[model samples]
Structures are given as structure tokens and as C-alpha cells.
Target: MTSTNDSNKAAPRKSGPSRRGAMKTIAGAAAALVAAPYIRPASAAPTALRALMWEAYAVRDVIGAFEEKHKVKFAPTFFDGNSEAYNKLRVGGTKDFDLVQADGFWPSLYFREKLIRDMDYAKIPGTANYFPAFKPDAFPLLKDETSGVFFGVPFCWGSYGITYNVGEVPVEKAKSLELLFSPDYSGRLATNARFEENIALAGIMVAHRMGTIDKPRPDGKSFNPYKLTDEELDGVEKLLIEQKPLLLTRYQDAATLEQLLVSGAIVAAPEFAQVYRLMLEKKAKGELDITVDHTLKPKEGGLGWVDTWLISSGVTDAEKADICHAFIDTMIKPETMVQIGKASGCSTTIDIRLLSSAEDQVLYLMNRTDELRGMYMFDQPSSTEKWERVWSRVQAA
Candidate 1:
């Protein structure tokens, strides 16, 4: 934490010496100087507040004001999916990164494992006005213990739903997951490759058909699609395998999926709203001549996500934690949240007054809480290990 001016205090002190002593001392000092640069660093390295989150969540324009206000560099590392982000945090990423803007519920695992630290809401007051857009139950996920020590702060809430080129798929037919399997689009369809999300989509179809989301498994056991039971996963896996041949590519990130969509290689897939924006950007910049626009929440409701901003537990520096909290404080502010909603099609905590052609107020579910019954939010299942094993079979198939 010391300044660069405090680089070294080992400079030789001035002293009187005999001529021979002075010459010997000078020679020795010269030798020491010759080896000094190799042995010691000239100055302390400048520190940056590191953020690991999704694409567009850390856009250059979105966080520009916060970066300037904090007078700190925002060093961002993005992940395509929540699984990869959690895996990285599990594998020493917690030690390297200071901030993580990941799935809204994922912080629960980090809180249980102590991978992330308790947040002082006093430090992140922006979260105080968290509702009117966020679900009432969403705040409970922030607390892992009864003592009320919170681990994470909420950021954006959105869906991993369908996006298809305008002309290729009609707006009416695009509102269902059935398109992913329809032979009409075989070899022209693409979808998210993430195990939980892809499998969850299958569960969504099941939930849609039977009118039994509370009991997702075909065997009649109660199961949440986000946390599918073993039997539930089995059903979902079978469905995905049956549809596999129809898929053109399995993608983990929005960028790759966007490339496929804009190139007209695949007509549709489950992707974030940002991809729709990317396609427009690409078209305007001449990166792609094609225009991609339609996005749908499956008739059965899509898998919804709420990404949270958490400071790593390994963050020992108080100053660094302050910087992370400062960034968090800006996240829910009306100005930044609007920019986020514009770049990302997700709903932000505060209402976004300014509207762009690409943005819609309904995406955040602002006053449309009635529709929430259909959306499935992300959750780490109790039977995660078993579900992951089943996912392996789905992929191997």
C-alpha cells in the first residue's frame, strides 16, 4: 500500500573516509548498484480492482463513470456461463480476483464455502433500493446465515432465452423450445451448451407440457427445474439427445452464438439479450450484412438469471474491498443501471427511464410481476453431483 516514492531505503549513507577507503567503498558501491536492479524491483506495481463477470456487464461505456470516479483501473475478466465462473472460483480464482459478478444465486455456494466474504450493506447502499424490479425472495439469497451477514449484492436479472434471425423463424413459433428440436431447422439450429441451462430448457418443456413444474420429474416426484432430481434429469437428457442431430453448434458464450446467428449459419438458439445488440453492432459496422432481432421467452417460460456482485473472501486489502464496494454502489444507480439495461437486455434494480430502440422495460419485469410465475430463476440444485453426471451422459450422447 506504500507509495512508489518509498521504493527503497537501502541507499548508502554519506560518511568520511580515507582516500584508499573511499576508492574501495566507491568500487564496492558500484558493484552493489550493478546487481541491485536484478535483486530488487525499482517501484511497487500499480494495483487494479479486478472484476470477473459476464460480457456487456462490464462494458467500456457502462462502467466508464465509476472507473473515472474511483480513479482506479477496472480490470475485467469475463465468463460465458455461470458454470465456468464457479469452476474458476473453486480453482484458486478467488485468490486472484477481487470482484465477481456472477449468477444471482451462485453467491450462496460461495457464501457456504466461504469463497466470498460478507458484505457490509452499509458499504454498498445502492442495494438498499433493490426492489420494485427484483423479486421479494431474491434478497434472501444474499444471506447464508441467520446472523444476517450477507455475502453478495444483486446486479442484473435476465433470461437465457431464444433468439433467431427475423425471417428464418416467425415470431409466433419462436416462443417455444420446440423449435430447437423441430426437424425443419435441423442442422440450422443452435443452443447453449451449458449443462445446467440446456438440461433446464428440456425441463422447461416438460414443465410446460404437464402443467407440473413443482413436480418436474416424469415419475411424479417434486423437482425444481433449476435443481432437477435424478429422475427429472434423466427425462431432460433423453429429450436433449433426441434433439442433438438438429443442432448445428453447441456454444458456451454469446459472442460465438452471435457469430453463428449473424452469419445465418444457425437460425436460433438460447442466448442473452446482448447477442441481439451485438448483431446490430456488427451489421452497422459492416462486420455482418445480416440483421438478427427476435428474442423470445419460451411459451413455457425461459430460464431466468440474476447475476450478483460479490467481493472475494481472499480480498485481504481493506482498500481493495472498498474499491469493489464503490463499483457495486454504482451498479444499481439509475444512470449506470439504464446503461446496463441498454447494453444487456436484462432487468436492472433501478428503473431505467431512458429507452433505446434495442431496450425494453418489460425485459426487467419492472411492473410485470404477473409474468414471473412462468420464469425459472437460477439455483444450485441439492442433487448437483447427480445432475452433472447425467449431463455428461447427455453430452456424450
Candidate 2:
């Protein structure tokens, strides 16, 4: 999982002085612009195509290959989460980026909001290489079917599951979601403190204990996870409030949680494939003993997320289309996909034969591709909103 240190951090100041100081700062502005040749006017395209995406995705060799194939240079930017990217591009109103990598769950919303453009699939031959189930329009939970029609192409996908330090908790015993809140595991369990993940995990656990499928109410207006009659949500609030004391730490980044596990400060935590791989690496080096539990509780569920490549609707340049397609094609090459899988610790929708045997297993489990196609894609807005509220309560409590 990705995390941001401070969502509220202010954006960097532009190279020039603020309006109030413009007259007095003329000399300073001249020096600033001269010092930073890389900072260009908002309307001007650089010699290269600019991209914003998850960290480590733009490996130098991969980028070099794309630039060589397309005959265009690339300027890459990195962000840890989709929300961060969206906020920066949207609120900042800077349109220099030609393409961006966004979490799949939000692209439809982004499309609806006119923040991104529909992709021209004909330009991206690699679209055919994606799993049929992962086609842009194939996400079952999305409300707008047309929004999936090539707005983005798959980058990577993974499941949210639990990872534990094997020296602290045996693999067999660590396979239950209940361990997250169990008193016995208090002071040992860690969870993603981000609103979305924390809420989704909490909702799944609540749904499991209440023995409900967690459907939107009959009217399709809201989720009734507990069959909660407002009164029971209050109880849930109290229960979650009581359990807060047991947690070791509520974290947002998988890397930080992995470190906590390695240090033995946290025995088990709800995490993704990256966390598991880090644990495996540590164990292999004899620095730690860790194991992942793929079969956590709520037999019917786990969280699954898809990341995709999208061209910003904000960009009107036709040149961007060619550049974006080249980037997508380069990314989908079997070798490139494998590298992405290795770096991101997630599975790509591309063919699996190209991946190492061990990585193939990791990808399979991460996507949970075989279990059922539409099992855990959390795309419903109301459900997401409820989850946010529930998670915030968990954090506050």
C-alpha cells in the first residue's frame, strides 16, 4: 500500500514572486528562473513527454526503451497514491503531464469529473494482451459502463491481505482476519491507517461477524454492513473505540509496517504483496522470519485494487496521444511487465508465462484472479463513503 506523509502539505511556491511582492521581487524572479531552466511556462511542452506515476515504475532502462522506440524523451514524476496525484493535478491546475497512473477504482470517477480523457485503444496494440476480465470496461462494480471503454489500461493489480512475522505468530494461526482486532493479538497487530483501507477492512470484519453479504440496502442507496439500525452503528462505534488501545500503530505505508514487523514491534498486519515480499526477503537473509496468510477470514472476501495508465483529459495536444500510447505499449511488453511486477510487488494483467515461477504465484494470489471475477472490487460510491466514515471512527477512537 502507498502512503503520504502529510496530505495537507502546501504545494511548492512557483519560481516567481507572489503578486503582492512582484514589484520588489523582480530581481529575485530573474535569478530564480535562470537558476531553474527545467521549470517552464505552464502552456509550453518540454522536449520530452511528462508522466506521473507510482514510484519505481519508471526504471531508467524501461524509460530509455520507451524514448528510443517513440523517439521522444520523457520527464517522469512520482506520487504514492491516486488521491495525491489527482489533488496535485486538479488543485494545482498544472497540465504539463501527458499521462498519469491512477488507481483503477477512481478512473471512472475521474472520467466523469472530466479530469482524464478516453484512451484511443487502436494506438495501443498491447491492449489485446490484457486479461479479458481486466478490460477497462470489465470492472463489474463501476456505475458507468462507458467510463471503462479505454479510459485507462491496466498497469498492475493486487489484493490486500495479512502478513505476519513467523517468529511471533505461526502461519497457520495467523490466517484469520479476527486477529486484527483480537485482544490476544492486541499490541501486536498493525493496519493501514488510510481512510479507505482501514474502512474496507473494518467493514469486511464487521460483515463477517454479522454474517451478512454487505449489500447496499434494498433501495440501493447505502450499505447495511451490520444490518445496522443506526443504534447498532453506535455500538460498533463504541466497540471500535474500545479496541483502539490494542493496536501497535495505525500506519499508512506498507514499507513502514514492514519495518515494524521486521523489528518485532508488530507481529501481524493487514498488508499487500509488497509487504509479504519484503518479509520473504528478510527471512531469506536471516534478518527476520515472516509468512503471509492468503486465506484470511470472511471466506467470501479480501480487498483488490487495480492501477491503470490514463491520459489526462486536460491535455488537448494530439502529440500526447502518440506519446501516451508508446508509453503504454512499452509498459505492456512481457519483460517490462515482469520488471513492474518485481518492483511494485503486484501482478499485471499481461500474460503470466513471462514471470518467474515464484512471482507467478505471488501475482496469482495478489489478484485472486481465479477465485471469482468480481468478488472484491470496491467501486460503489455509497459503500466507499460508509467505509470512510467507519474507518475515520476507528482512527479517532
Candidate 3:
């Protein structure tokens, strides 16, 4: 569901209005940031491009450049989680949106449900710029298994791993998921509010703790974090209930998580890559007395995802589809990728070739796939209802 990046120093901030500043300007005029559109010249009243994606895509640095280049306005509908985005497209039928973003396995589901259309890679020259690890073949879910048509273009990726205050939590202890459960760290921990990821992570921890990670479930199927048996889920539920009191809060947004870490409200949590990046930026700006870093590989593999851009099936107009392709290409451009990185604290999908700064390289895990190995990449849970029930009960408890 998330990935992490940690660095002692942050890359130099580029010259321009920061995303926060831009959002504030828009927010001052509008009641909702989600409905806010990129302010374009009054003389140029062209149709606005609509996107349903993460909050990152709504940032001015990510959307404004494309709007300027294509001479179009952008209206981004921000969703906190992938399922929330999928449900919106599924119900609204993409007529209101031209482009949609989903992570990991959702592309296949979208293709299967006819919610998204296959991409014309030739139209998206940016795909050619992707790193070797991100090539189409490496991601089976992005393509139709039978037709072999790719449905999405990846834009950013990282791990949902153990993030801790550098000096407060030693590296040796931080490298294991078990540390979160340790009493020593009790009352100094936190986690995301997403049910599926928390449940999946609990399943993963259970599997590893039982030394049954490589074994099959009672159903004789291979052990999958997302497909844990009810018995296994019971363990997960119990574990979460125990961890509930330990947490400072079940944070629901990146901003809250960033503030919690910077303020030292909590020592550590399983977090996305951008939180660490943002913390490093804060530290670089002398906003904190302590630094934040995350483990690349926790003993019990971390949760990870690669989010991609997809053209919705409702884009029936030829010109609209062309614009969609162009938008995808522009987003993946090396320069734009870095710009989005600055605003989103995420690494671009293409090769790390665009990053020259040592700090940037360290934050993006520059050209290395080793950290990705053994990670339980996010996937559709076998039983969403069950996972949701467990998570709700844990929260209430």
C-alpha cells in the first residue's frame, strides 16, 4: 500500500511556489481542495482535464506544468486510498474523469471490469524512459494476462516499512517488524488507518512469526498476506488489538504522520516513503532537532506498491484519449518526475538517471531492486469485508 525512502539530507528545494503554498492559494478561493482546478489564464477557456488520483497528483508542481504545456486546465479528485478511487470510477463510470490512478493489482481489476482501457505505449513515449525493473514484463498486473495489453503506466513507487527516529531507535531494532510490538516501544508507536494494509501487514507478521511464511494455508494454497485464513486472521486481529493502545494515533493522512514524527509525538511507525522524505526536508530546513529514517528491508518483509496512471474507459473521444496519452507521457518525463518528486516525496517510475544529487539518489534507492525483494507487494484482499470487520473492531477496542 506504501513504500519508504530515508535520507540524512534532502535534495535542494527548487524555485517555485511550493505545493502547500499553491494549495493554500486555491483553498482560500474554494471550499474544497478536491474540487479546486488549476487556475488558467482567463483568455484561455479550454476544457479542463479531469483526473481521479492521490493527493500528490493534485499538487501544482505536478499538475500546473502539464496544464501550461498542453494549454489545458486540470481538475484532480483526490482519494486517500486506492479502493476509494476504484469505487468512484466504478460508480461514476469515468465520464467525469479522463485519467485515473491505481496501485499494484487494481489495474487488472479495472481492465477486467472494463473501467479502464488498454494503453497505446507508442503514444506514451515516457514509457521508454522507465528503468529496467519497471518494464512492462516485470508487472503482470498492469497487462491483461490473455490479451497482453498494458492498462497502466507506473509513475512512482516505494515501500511501507518501519520508519523510526534515527537516534531514538537503533538500526538493529528498527530492521524488524517485531519492534513495533515490543513493549519497550509501546506508547511511542503509530500506524496508518487503512484496513487492508494493516490487516495484510498483520498477516505477514503472523506468517513470519510462525515460521510458516513459505507454507501453504489450511486451504492448501500458498500463504498470501492478503488471503490469510480466518484462523490466521484471528491472530492478526488479536495482534492489532494489542497494538491499538500502543499507538499515539491511527493517522489518516500524510500531513498528520509528518507532524507526528517531526514533533516527536511518536518514535516510529510503518510509513510510506514520502514521510521520511518530508521529514528529511524539514530537518534540512532546521525544523527539527531529530532526524527520521526507515528500514529498507524489515526482517518481516514490508508492504509496497507501484502506482500507475490509466486512461478510463469513458474517454470515448479520440482527441480526449490523445490528450490522456500526452498527459501520461508528460508526467513520466524525467524533469516532471523530479518535480512531482519534490511535491509528492515520491520517486519517479523511470530510471534514476534524472537524479544527480547524492541525497536524491539515497532517497529514491537509486538503481537498486534488492530492497524490493521479499516485500509483500499490495494486492486485492481475498475478503475485504472480513478485513474491514477486523480493522474496525481493532480501532473500536
Stretches of candidate 1 off by over 4 Å are: 1-47, 61-73, 128-131, 135-138, 207-212, 216-222, 277-296, 316-318, 354-373, 381-385
lDDT of each residue in 1-397, candidate 1, tens digit only = 3654465555555586779898999999999998764353424332567778877777676577767777777788888767778888899988768888767467887878778887877887676566554533455667865767777777776677777887888877787788888899989998877777777788877655665665445546545577655555667878888888999888867668877886788998887666875566566678876666544467766777667889998776577778778788877777778777767756675545454233355434565533444566776655678778777887788
Model 2 poorest ten-residue lDDT run: 223-232
Q: Write the per-residue lDDT of candidate 2 for residues 243-264, one digit (tens) a residue.
A: 6877888886877887787677
Model 1 accuracy (lDDT, Cα): 0.72
Model 1: how far is 200 from its true place, Å?
1.4
Q: Which candidate gets the maximum TM-score versus the true structure?
A: 3
Candidate 1, residue 16: Cα displacement in angstroms equals 28
Alpha-carbon RMSD of each model: 10.6, 12.7, 18.4
- Ranked by TM-score from best down, the candidates are 3, 2, 1
Backbone N/Cα/C clashes per model: 1, 2, 8
**337-377 per-residue lDDT for model 3 (tens digits):** 87777888876678756465887887777666545545777
Scanning candidate 3 in windows of ten residues, the lowest lDDT window is: 1-10
TM-score for predicted model 3 compared with the true structure? 0.84
Ordered list by lDDT, greatest first: 3, 1, 2
Q: Under the 3 Å rule for N, CA and C atoms, how many clashes does model 3 have?
A: 8
In candidate 1, clashing pairs total: 1
